[model samples]
Target: MITVKAPGKLYIAGEYAVLEPGHPAIIVALDRFITVSVSEATLQGTINSRQYAETDFHWRRSGDQMIFDNRDNPYHYILEAIRVVETLALEMGRPLKIYDLDINSQLEDQGGRKYGLGSSAAVTVATVKALCQFYELPLSRMDFFKLAAIAHFNVQGNGSLGDIAASVFGGWIAYSTFDKDWLRTVLQTNTFGEILASEWPGLKIELLHVPNELELLIGWTGSPASTSRLVDKITIAKFAEHEQYQHFLAESQKCVQKMINGIRNHHLPIVKAEIRHNRQLIKDLGFFSGVTIETPALQELCRIAEDCGGAAKSSGAGGGDCGIVLTDHTVDQARLISAWNQQQITTLPLSVFQLTEASV
Candidate 1:
């Protein structure tokens, strides 16, 4: 059996604005991961994941396509990964074969509540990695990332795909989104192999080093939010408030750029200040767009962290999920966590997942 794992991620700075091409976002991969294991099988292949569903999903290969016994399985990302990887395999003159894929996840809490830790992106990347190993493909990190991004975009159809980058690279990263409009137009005439080999406009991913004096903390609101839904609402608002939206995007870019510099230069003060500034920018965005990007619970979470002399903000689409805090080692972390507990927020113990040379 061949096994692979991908880490979940959180947006540290850039959120909604990162959707625009060339706009930068700072994201970090968490220690939590999604694992996929593949083994050879005869007749039919099975996909089993107790976290998603109880019953096994069966499939058979027909030429270069996969025909599933049941079409209503909750493995859209995984299935897409298989389709794209198999397409690449066939392009390389490799014959298809049946395999059993088993998946396990640690992106959720004890009650199976998702923490908005980019589980879908992690699973997609993990499946792609597992299949690449099973097929013995000579794929590089960038090639693997592009394949997984293509599979994810086919299903999601939106977002910056920064989560996919963090899952692929596994560390603190400064990422700029690619031009989705360009990809959509070129995909009509170009083959997957051609596109994979081509340069994607505005796409950038750089591993970062955090300052040694900084400490990161995560607090879960115990409520999940749909990132796509929030992005959809913001999309509509973007059309209605074009000028204001442009201003938001410009300011977000500036804030994220400074935050990236702070991380790169080991300037903790600038990082903390930019975090607070980004929080306000998102709040103003919610006010004008009527999207409620930050919930009251998230507001409380940030306020408590600020009271403790740290910087905090909603991690992702907001609405509900998790908030991240960045502080110096001198801050009283236990008191901050205890205050969060009083407000019914759960402080999650998570660390950054760094990639080694071998893994890369």
Candidate 2:
């Protein structure tokens, strides 16, 4: 069996604005991961996951496409990963082989509730990595990231794909999205290999170093938000309020850039200040966009963190899910966690998943 794992990601600073090309976001990979294991099979392949109730999903290859036995299968990301990676394999003169894929995830609770830790992106990355190993494809990190991004975009059709980068690189990263419009135009004339080798306009991913004295904390609101739904709403609102939306994007870029510099320079004060500024920017965005980016629970979560001497904000698309906090080591973490618990917020035990030389 060829086994591979990909880490979940949390957006630290940038949220809605990162959707635009060239806009920067600070994201970190969590220690929690989604694992994919692939083993050779005869004719048909099976995909099994306890998270999806232990039932085996069967599939077969027709030419270069993967056709599932069940039309209502819940393996959209997994199937897309297989399709794209197999396409690449066939292009490289390698025949596709049947394999049974086993998937396990740590990005959710015991009840299978997601923590909004980018589980979909992690699973897609893990599947791509597992299949690449199974096919003996020695792809570089950038190539792997591009492949996973393509698979994810085919399903999601929106967002920055910064989560894909975090899952692929596995560390604190400064990420900017590629031009989706350009990719869409190029796909008509280019193969996957050619696109992977070419330069993706406005795409950037750089690993960052965190300050030693800085402490990161995550609080879950026990509610999961659909990032795509929220983003769709924002997209509509953007057309109605184009000027305000542009201003929001500009401010978000500045705030994220400052936060990134703070992380690189080991300046906790600058990072904390930018976090607070970004929080207000998101709030203003929610007001104009007519979407509740931050729920009552998330507001309370951030309040408790601020009262305890930290900067806090909603993590992702932010209707409900997780909020991240950054504080110095001098703060009482136990008190912060206890305060969050009092308000029915669960403080998650997660750390940054750093990349090793071998993994990179």
lDDT of 1 by residue, 1-360 (tens): 998889999999989999998789999999999999999999899999969676669988777678886556798999999988988888877888999999999999877899999999999999999998888888888988999998999999999999999999988999999999888887787877888889999999999999999889999999899999999999998999999999999999999999999998999999999999999999999999999889999999999999999999999899999999998876899999999999999998999999886654
Compared with the true structure, all predictions reach lDDT values of 0.92, 0.93
Which portions of model 2 show Cα errors greater than 4 Å? 358-360
RMSD of 2: 1.1
Q: Each candidate: how many clashes?
A: 0, 0
- Give the number of colliding residue pairs in candidate 2: 0
Deviation in angstroms for 116 in model 2? 0.3
Tens-place lDDT per residue, model 2, 1-360, is: 888899999999989999998789999999999999999998898999979975668888777667776655889999899989988898888988988999999999999999999999999999999999899888998999999999999999998899999999988999999999998887788998899899999999999999988878999999999999999999998999999999999999999999999999999999999999999999999999999999999999999999999999999899999999998876788999999999999999999999886654
Minimum summed lDDT over a 10-residue window in model 2 is located at: 63-72
Candidate 1 local distance difference test against the native: 0.92
